[model samples]
Target: MKNMDVMLLSTSCIQSQLMKELLSESLGPSITLVNQHTFAYHDWNKPALILVDLANLPTSNQPWELYLRGFKDNISTVLLNTQDSISAQKLLQWPNVYGYFSHYEDQETLIRGLTKVLKGEHWIPRSMLIEMLLYLQSIKPITTTSIELTSREIDVLNLLSNGKSNTEIANELFVSEHTIKSHLYKAFKKINVKNRVQAKRWARCHLPLYDG
Candidate 1:
């Protein structure tokens, strides 16, 4: 049987090893586990998939951000988290963020999420998905602007309106926390808002049904 070449990144050496064992035991020797710090410097093109544990690492480093930006077209990213709201918002904006799984999710769910991501599908927990949809509904346009945002950017805006932090948003969207911040930085500039609080207030005021 051919093994799927997977690169697992985690700050916890033990957890990384455990995940490596799990993947090897379940899917066979085709999977390879590399330490997160080392994996960041390696060429990402060789992996069938890359699994990132956002909750376990720092998000502000330039190297990590560069790695993510560079790999968007070269490989798939599967972000695992404990549902950090702000993180979810930032990560969802990146086109490469394909899958998200909560730490609380069962093993079957984790496998299913990874499988879906590998198949080029975007996967988010059901509850978070619904919340995102509802947020979009709440922020429906009252007026169209000259400014434009991608569908994913708009999704990030809606989550911001719901008071989620970048970390939370990243987890929700299955993206790296750094990716989420990048989106917010661009979104804020485009929307003419200075910070998350201002952005949310502006969105609420401009959105069709927002009473505030």
Candidate 2:
């Protein structure tokens, strides 16, 4: 595992430096630590695990998403400083995101989680994982005939399946929240699904954008 790169992305210079030192001292020479800017000038040919400090992200730009998107599918990600499980779950919709470290976690816990993640295992909290499993269990497969969706409804459902909230979707589409709800209601009717999770499962099965 010598020279394995683990990049830490945090907008706060102080936080990035402190975390780099802490992680380097803790994990030893087997892991190479990179700051947010180091990877830009270098070609990362091997699969790397990215540690993103979500709490320090710029509220306006969301540059982290763009940075993560630049990586190949082999890139694994673990979100750090997550405030709550709901937001963490939503963020996990990204295919590369494997797990998260809560804001309240101590250094020992953080190190333990990172070690597990390095071993190609998820380090999510047990409670959060249970909640997620319950939600997934509730999403029953729905069989429907040929369904016709308006362009706007398709757009709404796509964002919804990507774990976007109604407000976020409305802002992205530049429409009112009420209008987004109307679109969702119509889409739900068309898809013959009742709620967001079911709709998301249906989209994963049927929608070309997210179809596996």
Candidate 3:
């Protein structure tokens, strides 16, 4: 209620007016709702949350998306009236997008979610959060030398990436399966991987001599 700015980017004048009134009443009169069709003239550095209605935008690269690319720092955004989870997930991948509201969301749910977003908290689903985390983990830079893996661990990972099972790796290394498991566990911990598949993926990216 302390003059928090909320910019509504919508094409329809009637809808924008209605939404502005609703938000003002629900979120308190101190909340400033800057209803506008374009965002080019606004100061990008201001502390404001942008609520973009995706329904009125074209199917291609949106105006907000293009405008967002200009700024070096992240701008907080909440996507409204998203068609489905696929689009929501894709948009949420942008660092600025922290909240989403489907067309089917009730007034109460929308208001509650907006409140959370205003507090600088994420309003995304748990499943989406998990998927984002996994994606970030996969793309995160980890040089092979950074983890300082033991020679046996590196050998095990190289073989693992080449579709070799634990038993096969053990046989190739002339060590027992238990020893191979120990090496894998240590490697996984060092590399922050939870399982063989993740370890293998990491190996493929970091290990230059990986066969697979």
- Ranking the candidates on lDDT from highest down gives 2, 3, 1
Summarize candidate 3's per-residue lDDT along 1-212 as a digit string, tens digits: 13445777766567766887888788654433443334666765566667777776553333344344324353567888887655333654344777788888999999998888776788988877787677556553435466787555766787788788888776655569999899888899999999988988889888644544
Two-way lDDT contest, 2 vs 3, winner: 2
RMSD of each: 8.5, 8.7, 15.5
Q: lDDT by residue for model 1 over 1-212, one digit each (tens)?
A: 12336777666577767876886676444566665456655754454576777667666423454345433355666777646553433454344566677667788888766666656677866676676666656555644576676555665676678777888777656579898888888888877889878989877776432223
Per-residue error (Å), model 3, residue 23? 1.1
TM-score per candidate, chains pooled: 0.52, 0.57, 0.57
Candidate 1 weakest ten by summed lDDT? 61-70
| Residue pair clashes in candidate 3 | none
Cα error, candidate 2, residue 52 (Å)? 0.6
Q: For all candidates, what are the clash counts?
A: 23, 0, 0
